[model samples]
Target: MLKEFRDFIAKGNVLDMAIGVVMASAFTSIVNSMVSDIIMPFVEAALGSTDFTSIVVKVAGITFRIGNFMQAVFTFLIISIVLFFVMKAVASLKNRFTHEEEEEEEEVDPTEALLTEIRDLLREEKQSASK
Candidate 1:
């Protein structure tokens, strides 16, 4: 059981997941900042009192802060957009490395390979004969 646990922990998939979780948490903080600190402030400045969290309404003894809901929705939107671009960039980088490896491993026709080997051998013989 201990050995199995150790093997699971040592797997690259598990390690990769751990690293991804750490990176995602860091990315979330940055996106949250961009939405709350930067974008929301700009949006509020333009709207001139659009702080939905502070706005509340009471109807039939039930109170609802619709503004908070709006704010949450807007924040969600910003986070989604930011994450979309971040993931897109990460995918492009991954594709670049994978594409490079694929190109390196590109299959060469056997006939072409054989012909090239023959050509090299012929060249070597020609050089030796000239010498």
Candidate 2:
């Protein structure tokens, strides 16, 4: 059981997933900061300095914070768009590196060639003997 656990932990996919989780967490923080600190200020400026997070509505004793919800929705949209472009750029870079214009030369396997030669020789011997 211990060996199995160790093998599972040592797998490449598990390590990659762990790294991805860490990177995504850091990316989330950067996106959150970009939305709240930079973008929201500009939006606020354009909207006459209205505090979107403070706008709320109360109905039948239930308080609804529509402004905060809108802010969150905008933040999510920005983050998703940023991530989409980032992923697209990364995919393009990866393709650029992995794609080659020059044609790759195909090499025949020596063992397979030898096996075919042996089979041909045996067939020739059998046909000659039959004749």
C-alpha TM-scores of all predictions: 0.63, 0.62
Candidate 2 deviant stretches above 4 angstroms:
49-51, 100-131
Candidate No. with top TM-score:
1
Global fold similarity of model 1 (TM-score)? 0.63
- Cα misplacement distance, residue 117 of candidate 1 (Å): 9.1
Give per-residue CA lDDT, model 1, range 12-116, as digits (tens).
Answer: 999999999999899778888887787777777888854669878999999998879987887788778877888899999999999999998897889999999
The residue-by-residue lDDT of candidate 2 on 1-131, one tens digit each, is 99999999999999999999999898888877876787777777887763568889999999999999977777677778877887899999888766642223245578989999999999999999999
Residue pairs with backbone overlap in model 1: 52-67
Model 2 residue 29 lDDT score: 84
**In order, what is each prediction's RMSD in angstroms?**
6.7, 6.1
Error of 2 at 2 (Å): 1.6
